[model samples]
Structure formats: structure tokens, C-alpha cells
Target: MRRQVLFVGLICVTFLVNAQEEKTIDLDEVTIQASSIIRKKDRQLIFPSKDQVRRSMDGLDLTRRMSLPRLWVDPNTKSISMANGNVQLRINGVLASSLEVAALSPEDIKRVEYHDNPGLRYGEGVDIVLDYITIKRTSGGNLGVDLSHQLNTFWRADYIYGKYNRGRSEFSLSSFANGHRYKEAWQDRTEIFHTPDGTFQRTQEGISGRDYEMYWTTTANYNYTKDDDYFLNAKLNFYYYDYPHNYSSALLRNSESKMTTDLIDNNKSLNTRPSLDLYYFRKLPRKQSLAVNVVGTYSNTDSRHTYREELESIPLTDIYTKVDGKRYYPLVIGIPCAM
Candidate 1:
């Protein structure tokens, strides 16, 4: 009886790569030695389809959901960066991270499976060194509310909200209010060349473009499962970054004649990016599925740089006595003249 079943199975897979040659994978060599597990699954594992899975899961009302810790992925990549330990990632004729993967709905997902373990069947041939999770794919999220004060240098507040389902969904939102005090400055140095006759011929000046930054993120999400009944999977995220700076100092020529007094300058800039994601999934029985996901993002940034310098002469001390002058203008120096 067993030989007859095997013969039929072989016929189904007759398109073997090396048909002309014969090779056999010894059962002992193919076995993983985990006898207890092999026996346990053959007798208990269940591959439930949608109708059956929903029926089983619906047992728990919407009031409460099951929670299982699973790896979280970047969504776009089939890469799982985290795992809850057991690492059940693959099986005979089955693969993990397949496009038709069953997701209950962002809201129904009780737990996600994430196994970076090289021991995973899918990674048995992968090098052991490249198997760790990334910061973005970590499997932990929580909620918290914070109060902030911006009346001083170290004043700020934050709030957090997060959640994830075992089968289909995840969500989170966070915001921060802040106030900061800062001081920044710029410096310029110049060298001039002159002949034995004195005066000047050319100049070389160095200007440093510099600044400081501060910002925060405010965002939210609502992802749906890989189920057909749930047509839309949605997501949204936003962030705003800000920077304010102040600088001083610019070279005054005949520099030897100037006291090189101090100067003050100020500038401010802001940047923001907003993005939204939506997708659709359709499943066909016989283990086939298709999905279409779309993403939209927009970003805007503005910058302002202000710089100026002041020069004051020291007592007539004959030094640079040949020249003396104070420059007080919008300090706007337009394009330089070649001559």
C-alpha cells in the first residue's frame, strides 16, 4: 500500500532536474533527528483555510484578541527581522513570507512570527553570520502619555500609543512638544598676497557652513490582514524637523588695522514629510494569491542662512594707519568681481 502511494506521488513530481541520472536522499540523512516533533506534527498540525480559520478565530469576540509574539517585517521586503524563539518558518512544500500569506486584518492579527534563526528551514543554506534582526523590525510596541514644558532649555513632553494583532494588523501614534535654547557661530579667515612694494594682489578666504537641528515625529497606522473580505490595508506616517541657529564673524581686510570686534547672526529652517500606504489582497484556493500595494509620500524643506561681521580699529597705534573704515550695511555682499 505504501509503495503504491509513493509511486503516485513520484508521478506528480516527474519533472525532476536530473531525470537521466538517479540519486537517492537517504531517509536517515534527510531526518532532522527531532523524532518527538516529527511525530507530534504528523498527528496534530492543521492547515486551516480562510473559512475554517475565521470560524476557529471568531470564537473570541472582537472585545478581546489573541496575542502571539512574531517577527515584524519591513512590509515591502519578505525579510523577517525578529522571532519569538520556536522559529516555525517552513515545512515540506511550504514556504514562509509567501505573497499569499494569510493575514487576518491589521486588527485581527494576534501575533506575528519573526524568525531570524539560521536554523529555520528557509535559511538552512544561508550563512550563519547574517542572521540578526534590525532596529525597524523589532517585535515590541507599547503606549504612554507624557507632559512637556518648553518654557526653558530642557523643557519637553511626549505621548505614545501602539498595538498589534496576531493575524492581521498593527497601529501606533506618538507626539512630542518641545522648547530649546541654543547658540551657534561661524568663523572666516583670509590671507592676502602683496609684492615687496606693499598693498595687495589677491585674497584667499575660508568660510564654514554650519548649523544645529532639533525635531519630532507624529504619526499613525491601520494595516489590514491578507484576507480578501478585507479589501483595504491602510497606513499613514508624518514627521517634522526644525533647526534654529545663530552665528558670528567675517574677515575684515587690512585686518591688522581692525580690533576685530564680535558680531551676531541668526537663521532658521524647517522640514517635514508625510506618507500614506494602501493595498489590496486576493486569495485563490490551491495555495495561490495576489496582492497590490501603493504608497505616496511628500516632503518639504526650507532653509535660511544669515552671516555678518563688524570691525573696530584699535587706537591709532600706527598699525595699518594707512587705512581705517567701519562697514555697517545689510551686510549683503553680492557676486564677487573677478577684478
Candidate 2:
């Protein structure tokens, strides 16, 4: 028995020694980089750093600096767009306008939420949505101005905004304008006619033209808010657009006829629009909320167009048309709440 026990112990010691002789293998180093974007199931949240907020002039400027993926920010229009599509803007779940965006204080922003695919709650045709979550301030104000001009062109965009908050009440006023008034514009196009007869092609070569286009909007806002409770906002907007002159003179040459014609086209349009918006929001228990929005608007418009064509000094075609119209939009109400 002693002999057998000694033999087993020797075998166990040999197995233990082999187990202790296991080798260690070194692995290649891996680097993991963190991104600023936080993706959720249905949305992406972007948190702006202190440096980003400090350098931004206003809410619109902050958004422009974010360089959001697949979204284009246009400073001239104070708008955000995607490829051939529009993105809806909101402030803390409430619909926001350009005036509100201009009046926003960059310091108050907490995070930006982007929804690439909207659910049915947002209604049809609503693909993209941007929601700006903000921290409520009891008192303070903001003033901002944005101006851009092209050195070689006569186009300019101007915006001015002011806001003041006292206690739980806030007031803001903002105005934005974009337009160009110049006589040295250019336009070129190719026209094709497909009929039972042989196809005809006309290519227009423009030398010089005149353009006058302007769009202006101003808004006054009053808001009441209580942190973690409820809020009410009332806004009045006045919008105007004028394109008094858009004249283009070009040489139209027919590829088949081997003929050239002098063509001049002119267009003019004017619009006056006024709108009112009312919004209310209340927070509920169990992380629920209720919101209501109402909007009403009225518009008046005038438009005119004229076309003149001549082979020589004499006119071959002269066409003119004018239209004037007025419209009133009834109150539009929306309620999006969670229980």
C-alpha cells in the first residue's frame, strides 16, 4: 500500500508541475475612442461642450457649429434642412419658430435631440425632428445679431434679436431679413420641345439681368414658466416678401432652325402675412406631460409676369399676366401628450 501511494503521489506532482508550466501570450494593443454623439433607439442626443456654447452667438449659431450629420444649416434663412427635405424644430417639446430660435440663449441649452425616423405621433411626412432641451432660468436675457454678405454679390442676410426674463416671465423680440437688390445677375437654361413634329431645342445664353428679392419677418413673444411645472407662450409674427423685379434678357438660339432670338422675361411678387401662436405645456406625475398649440395666420399676395421675344427690333411675342389674392387661415390646434 505504501508503494502504491508513493507512485500515485509522484504522478500527481508531475501533473501539477505541467499545469504550472502554462505559457502566457501577449496580445496586440487596441485603442477605443469615445464619440460625442449618443444614439438611442429612435433618436440621437448631442451634448454641446462648454467651449462650443461659449463661442456660439445664439441658438442658431450653436446649431451651425454642431455640424450635425446629414443636416445642412443655412445662416441666411436661419433654417436646417436635409437632402431635399425639411426638419422640424422644437423647444422642450413645443413647436418653435425662427424668431424663437434667434432669441434662444446658447448658455441655456442642455442638449439637442435629433430624430431621424419619426413615429406616427408626429403625423405623416414628418421624417426628421430636432428638439432643443433647455434649462429654465428665473432671470436674465439675451441679445444677438447675425449678418452675412457676399463680397462679389449683392446678397445679404440680417437678423436682430433681444430677450429679457424677469422672475417667471420672459419677453423677446426678433427680426430677420434676407434678400438681394442688384442689376448684375445671371441666368442660363436649356429648353426642349417634344412633339409629333421633329424635336426642337432652345438654349438660352444670358449676359446680364436684374433681380430684387427680399424676405422679412418680425416676432414679439411673451412666455410664462415655472420650473418642473408648466409654461405658457404667446407669439405674434409679421412676415413680408417682395420680389419687385426679376428681369432676365437672354439670346435664344434654335439648334434646328439655326435662328437666334432676343428674349426678355420679368416677374414681380409681393406678400404680407401675419400669424399668432399660443402654446401651453404642463408636467405630470410618472414622467408624463401635456402640451397644446394653436396657430392662426392671414396672407395677402400680388404677383405679375411678363415675357417678350423679338427676332430683330420688332417684337414677335409679348405676354403678360397679373394675379392678386387674399387668404385667411383658421386656427390650427394640436395636442401631443403622454399619460
Candidate 3:
């Protein structure tokens, strides 16, 4: 019940700007921080972006690790706070992915660097500050696939696949899922310690409820690399959630008969969230990189609470059956109220 409110809603960025700062991914090529770096294989540009950091470390992390220079992100809150402290990140003279210093998987990284001073290619007209991040996809590299499984109350699995090569092509994909059956029983007690004569009524009522859940999320991406060393990526991500519930309650008293009923039936919900990303990547000779990413998202929830009640033979107690040579009955006789 507590998980519904935070289903989805998030964003972070506090700064003045004139045209979005180029993605920090292009920082290595455009800024001076990436000066002390070396590339072993065919490369165009590599930069830093904590985007994956927040993703891999989401509320329920699967199996991914990230390295960042400086950042404060909470999984429960989905909020982030970062500062570069005189360090400016740039990509081809433009701002890139928002991050100060970072580390991530090779597939998600193009290049990396540490700049001591800010440069014109880093920012256009934004208030200059220290610290930045740049990131982009590899153009023609081979993809490495990662998958894992956890067998328990339900089957759970995660996957990651993507590649880049010779700075000319790129692609990536990730997913998480689980299925299982769970059984739980709940009992609640309420007492009104009061009577019509202001004495001790000691009214006690007990309630019980049960629930079940099944969920999963999947995302796919595609990228186009141009000879000019600029990368154009089209990303589509889809995620959803589903859960069902049931409930019942009862009341008892010494002077009156006990009453019981099912309060909920067929109460269920299905939710979905889809997002799109458009970003660019550029690499510089000095080991600096740059990138620009713009993303939009949409989410929807569909739910319903169903209920029902059925009673047979208006005089339920008068009608009885024989048990162990004796007659058993509900034992109730009173005036009915139409109100």
C-alpha cells in the first residue's frame, strides 16, 4: 500500500543556462580535464555520465556497479545532488550528461579525463562552474551480453547487451523480471472500551487481509555513428507493474450475534511507464569527449476495486441441517431495519 504514492516522478538540475549545456559525455574531447588519459583500442571519444549510475542503482538494483567523482543520490527518494567545485565539464565545447566525475561499464563509456580549468568549448553562455561529465556510445565495438538468475519464491533474471567499435557504431539493451506465488495472513484487532451508559463496552473487532504481486521491466536502444565522429542514438524504454488484493472482517459480542463479510474482491491494478531518448556523442584528440542527451517519459496506471455480497433464505438461522444427531443453526431472530 505504501509503494503506490512514489510509483513514478523524477528530475534534477539547478542552474542557469543559455541553450542546454552540451552533454558532459563530450567533456574529454572538449575540456582540458581529460588530458591525462590513454586509449588502448580504436576510439573516437569517451566521456562520463552518471545516468547509468542512477539507473543501475534504482530502488531495486539488480547487478551493476558505477564510479562517480562526486554525487548524492537516494534510491527511495530518487533525488540527486552534485557539485564540481571549480571543475568544468565540456564536450566539443558544449555541456554534456550532468555529472562531476564518474565510472561505468565499458559499453556505456567512450573516454574519461580530469580537467583543472574551464574552456570556451565547454560552455556557451551558462554560469561556469567546476566539475563535469561526458559520455557517448562506441561506434563499431562488439557487444558483451550479461545475464543472471535467482531461484526462490519466484524466478528472477536480468540482462544487459550493447556494443561499439572503431568509433563508428553503437547499440544497447537491458531488462529485469520475476514471477512467483506468495501466501500471507494478517489479523487486526480494534477495541472501543466504551458503553451506552459511559461504562466499559469493551467492543473488539478483528480483520484480516492478503495480497500478491508480479512485475517486470524491459528496455531496448539503437545508435547511428557518422564518420564525422558524431553519434546519434534512438532509445526506447518500457516498464510496468501489476498487483492484486483481497480482504475480509468480522465482529463479535456476548449479547448480539457475530457478523462477518468479505470487504474486497477482484481489486487489481496495472501500471506502465515508457520513455524516449535522443543524444549525440563526439570525441576529441586530447582524450576529452562530449555528448548531449534529451529524454522524455510517460506513465499510466489502470486499476479497479470490485465488490459483491450474497445472502440466501431471508431467515438464515431458521433453516438448519442435522449434524451428529443434532440440529445446527445460525441462531438469529430480530427485527430487520430497512434504513
Candidate 4:
């Protein structure tokens, strides 16, 4: 009996050893390599790879490919936003417009400097800054066009950009236009209002008339840069917007004895803005610099609205309003000093 018990104990030990061996695992080593990012105290410098530049269509596309943290890029709107605040885009320390960014060539980009903490030099309310450094171009030119439209809706947008560089100067022109028109819009809603006279309920139904909008902007810019020692830029911009027809008519029924009334509202507006900008920069000794900016702008707006209520095609109430305003700044100058 003792021999039998010892044999059984040995068998159990062998089974346990086999189970432990089956549960054991062997792992392979893994190594992680850093990407093209340089970390600094207050900012980070990023370099785009050859592959990234080759696939990118423009500066905006390259920025999206970089996948910078907390930065959002919308291709449809051609806008960039950051978390908690707005993002400031600059080219070699100079503020850049959307058109300038769109006209940039990925091949000309050298490096990007990102700053999350800005000093007093940037002024107040400056949250983040992205500075794009570009390589010197002896002579070159680029032309591009962007178009977007909805599949089933009457919405369309187009942008055309062209730039030419020679020696130490560059010229660029860009235009953006978009339009929308709604053929048929129907509204069915119930509204309840409490007035001084009494509480009333309104039920509106039927077709809301055609609505249309149009907008366009054009910019012309000239820039001169001589080895970073001297810089000058001049830009002119013109913008126009028109909303000539926004008419809505509906059959409104009131709670008072189920009375029916025809409601119609019409609104239209026109706006125009023209602006000119000039900037100059010079490098001074002892790590100091001189910068000057000048701007002139004018804006005008004209709006008109009409409202009417009719019973059995007879007008019961009619109201109309018109507003016109214009403003202009002949000259505005600013100088910034850095040490």
C-alpha cells in the first residue's frame, strides 16, 4: 500500500510540472524610436519628412499631416483652431493671412516653431503661436485652385491662388468666392407667446420662399525680403457680400376662433470692406529689431427688412425698416520694438 501511494504522488507531481511549463511565455524585445520633434523649454521644433511633404498639397495640408497636439484643421472651411483659444499663424515672425497660408508651397518650408507660452512682445490674449520658416527662393512660381460643393444642395465655393518669386521679391494674388441658394424651404411650427394682452398660440405651416447669399474676396500682396536683414510687405484686400432676397411666407392660424392670417417677412443686406496693409521690419544690433505696420480700412453696410400680415389678401399690418452705415480709418500705424 505504501508503494502504491508513493507512485500516485509522483504522477501528480509530473502533471503539475507539465501544466507549469505550458503556462510559461517567452516575450520579444521592443525598441521605440523618437520622431522628428525637438523639445525645448517653452516650445517645440518640428521638421517635416520627405514623405509628408510629397503627399501634402499645401501648407494647410502639411499642417494637418503634422498632427500637432491640441490643434484642429478643417479642410472644408480652410480654418485652423486650437484648444481653449485662437491660434496665431506667422511666417518668419510676421503675421500671416489665410490666403498667404494657402499659397505656401510645401517644398519651400524649412521648419516649424511652435510656442505655447508667449511673452509681453506678443501682447495680450495671445495663447499659441505657430511660426513657419521658409527657404530662400531665387525664382519660382506656383498656381493652385480649390473647389468644393455639396452633392444635393445649392452650395459651392472656389479659391484660386497664384504666386511668383524672383530674386528677393515675391508677388501673389488670391480670390475666394462662394454662393448658396435654397429653392424650396418648408416650415411647420407651433409658437406660444405670453403678451401683456393675453397668452396666444400660433401655428404656422406652408412654404418659406427662396433664400440666397453671395460672397467674394480678393487680395493682392507683394513681399520683399533680403537675407532677413530687411523685410517689407504690402497687401490690398477687397471683400463684398450680398443677401438680396430672404423671403418667407406662411399660413398662420391663431387660437382665437381658429382665425387664419398670411405672414410674410423679407430681409436683405449688402456689405463691402476694402483695406490696405503695409509692414516693414529691420534687424538691429545687439539682438534688437525694429518693426512697423500701417493699415487703412473702410466698411459700409446697407440693410432693409419688411414685415406684413394679411387676412384674405387684405393687409392688416405692414412695417418696414432700413439702415445704412459707413466707417473708414484713413491711416493707422503701429511700431513694435524687440530686445
Candidate 4 structure lDDT: 0.78
**Model 4 weakest lDDT span, ten residues long:** 11-20
- For candidate 2, the lDDT comes to 0.78
Residue 23 in candidate 2, Cα distance off native in Å: 59
Model 3 TM-score (2 dp): 0.42
Note the residue pairs that clash in candidate 2.
Answer: none
Please write out the lDDT profile of model 2 over residues 1-339, one tens digit for every residue.
001111111111100000111245776796545566899999999988778898876788898898887787776588777896667888877777755775687777889998988887666787788899986665666666666666655566777788777778878788888887675666788989998987988899886766778999998988898885888989898999999988788899998877789998989999999999898888878878877778888999999999999997789999999999999886765564676
| Candidate 4 segments whose C-alpha is farther than 4 A from its true place | 1-35, 82-84, 117-126, 148-154, 186-188, 194-200, 312-317
lDDT by residue (1-339, candidate 1, tens digit) is 001111111111111111112245677645353221111311222222334335431211111222222434332221233443333332111222211121212223222222333433333444211111111211334333334443323334333334443334544444443444433234554457666777653222333334455666654545444433333455565667777553333334453453344333456667777776555555556655554556677777676654444445432222111112222222111221121
Best by TM-score, which number? 2
- lDDT of model 4, residue 75: 69
Candidate No. with top lDDT: 4
Please rank every candidate by TM-score, starting with the best: 2, 4, 3, 1
Arrange candidates by lDDT, descending: 4, 2, 3, 1
Query: Candidate 1: where is the Cα deviation over 4 Å?
Result: 1-142, 146-152, 164-171, 177-179, 183-214, 226-232, 248-265, 281-289, 310-339
By TM-score, the better pick of 2 and 4 is: 2
